[model samples]
Target: MRFNRGRRSFLLGTAATFVADFVLLVPGLLSGRSVRAAGQPVSADSTVITVDSTVIDVSQGAASGALALVTGTTFNTSGTPEQGVRVRALDPATRNEFARVFSDANGQYSLNLDPGIYEIRANKSGWGAISIAVTAGAGATHIVDFGNGAPPPPPQEGTGLVTGTTFNASGTPEQGVRVRALDPATRNEFARVFSDANGQYSLDLDPGIYEIRANKSGWGATSLGVTVVAGATHTVDFGSGTAPPPPPPQETALLTGTTFNASGALEEAVRVRALDPATRDEFARVFSDANGQYSLDLDPGTYTIRANKPGWGAISMAVTVVAGEIRILDISP
Candidate 1:
């Protein structure tokens, strides 16, 4: 349509203003700036805008093809959860790192990785690093756990270690001593180790009360009681010097006795008995032969002697026996 100068100029000015607004908004949109609609600025709430040209896979939750998802957890050598451990997915063929993440508080981590052979490594401070080879499939989920290159930990949790030193009664470090950790409740030796040349020893053990026994040849054995806590190293010391006192001299006293009837003649087929003066406990018993004589070895102690026969009355007397000495006693019934 033909228009007058005034109307055409006005329309031209309005079109130019609209074009300028479009140009300014274009840069803002690319820079993540919010847009206003209907003359009011949009709130901070975001709206997801999808383009028709972009295709999404309903089943895979990605485009027609995407990288695989890898999830796993990191643990210490003792199998305790290791949070904040750094995990990396490496392509061994190219030695390139494709993805990296830090483990969560639960020691869990996830990564979107391209389908290929990868070397997954996990590392943390004070822990041995671990790496594992895996073949990831596209659109597939895989798991790879790490335990600092150590064997799987025992099922029991929160276990700890015990360490100690062995010393002689003279306060000198004792080497080659055998240290044993015994479970008090079960009375079983759960763990054992030897003291090194420096008299240092260690044992990984469970939490509980234990008796640590240290022993060696020519040295007396010593034991100490300890209570172990989870994830802790309990230290103990043993001064096990000084040889045990010599065993009391073996009993070697000889007691010879004769049983006789009221006539004071040798009584054949008679019974002779020796009893301890204290506790009234029977100490020894012997029977006289056809000659009515019996002999017995006993510790050096005082004892009561008695003579007995089925038809004869019982006779009793007090006798003292001495070590390495032979004593003769006569019993009459």
Candidate 2:
């Protein structure tokens, strides 16, 4: 199953306006392809170049081989969809440009390429540029959003920057994981953001001690304590150590049910989630099917089951499952 999780929203201050222009000497394209804009170019040799209104079409080149689709949206520092953002795919080893396109008014773009590993770069005028490595598989569509790497305003007085990456149990960079910085004494969250496609994240906070935690659904969480120093950048990574051994198999219980609306009619597309009461960690989540049915298999334990839909109030109930037993719990309203 494919999941296109939403990117984290950022609250960045306004950026300085500048003029940028550069030339791209792509192998097949015309030599000295100059892109003229009003701002200072971020990188003269950048593999990706942003154009004001002109879009260089390279879809035909990509269509000549086995096809893989790359699609995503582009957002500015203020978390607004940005139009005309240029997205380019290039060969990682040789830095050769493969396909190029510009985002639409909705900040959405798509590119076709041969199945392989490539560096994808996204850039727009007045915003910072970003490049991330991605593996494109034949006939598969991959999502890569350009919402990070925006040059943030200078840090405030006595504040420092915290930056790091999040990895999974296998030590592979994991995207869309939420990272939070909290005050150790009060346990109040100071800042929170999701990692980018490269599994990288950054936070700016005042000089103080904080507990940084990284978490994602269905994954073990890792955290640490760090002291933020004035004018210094601290690096902290999560789940980058050796992978732990697999756990022993345990007996599981089945939970299944149907959902109905307040009017006693079957309801579809309701989100059902089960959470561990002690740690408040989510154990399973699924949406009701067309028949208003949902199911989950979990280890024997007590759980808080909650069901909610967009236009209705949420419903919650507590239940305990027994090993090798099937439990039926229906939800309404």
Q: After superposition, how far is residue 131 of candidate 2 from its true place, in Å?
A: 16
Quote the lDDT for 102 in model 1: 66
**lDDT of candidates 1 onward, in order:** 0.53, 0.59
After superposition, which runs of candidate 1 have C-alpha atoms over 4 Å from their true positions? 1-65, 148-333
Per-residue error at 82 for model 1, in Å? 0.3
lDDT of 2 by residue, 82-201 (tens): 877887877655667776666767787777666776667776667545555555777667666676433322333467766677777567777767777775446677666566655676
Model 1 lDDT tens row, 1-333: 111221232222211211100101221121111122332322212221223222211121221245676667777645677777777777644546765566767777666566766666666666545554455677767666665333322212365555656676566667667777675335476665556444555655666656566677865455544455677655566653322211222344656656688887867556666677766676555455334555554567888877677997887788887766667676776
TM-score of 1: 0.28
Backbone clashes, candidate 2: 7
Model 1 poorest 10 in a row by lDDT: 15-24
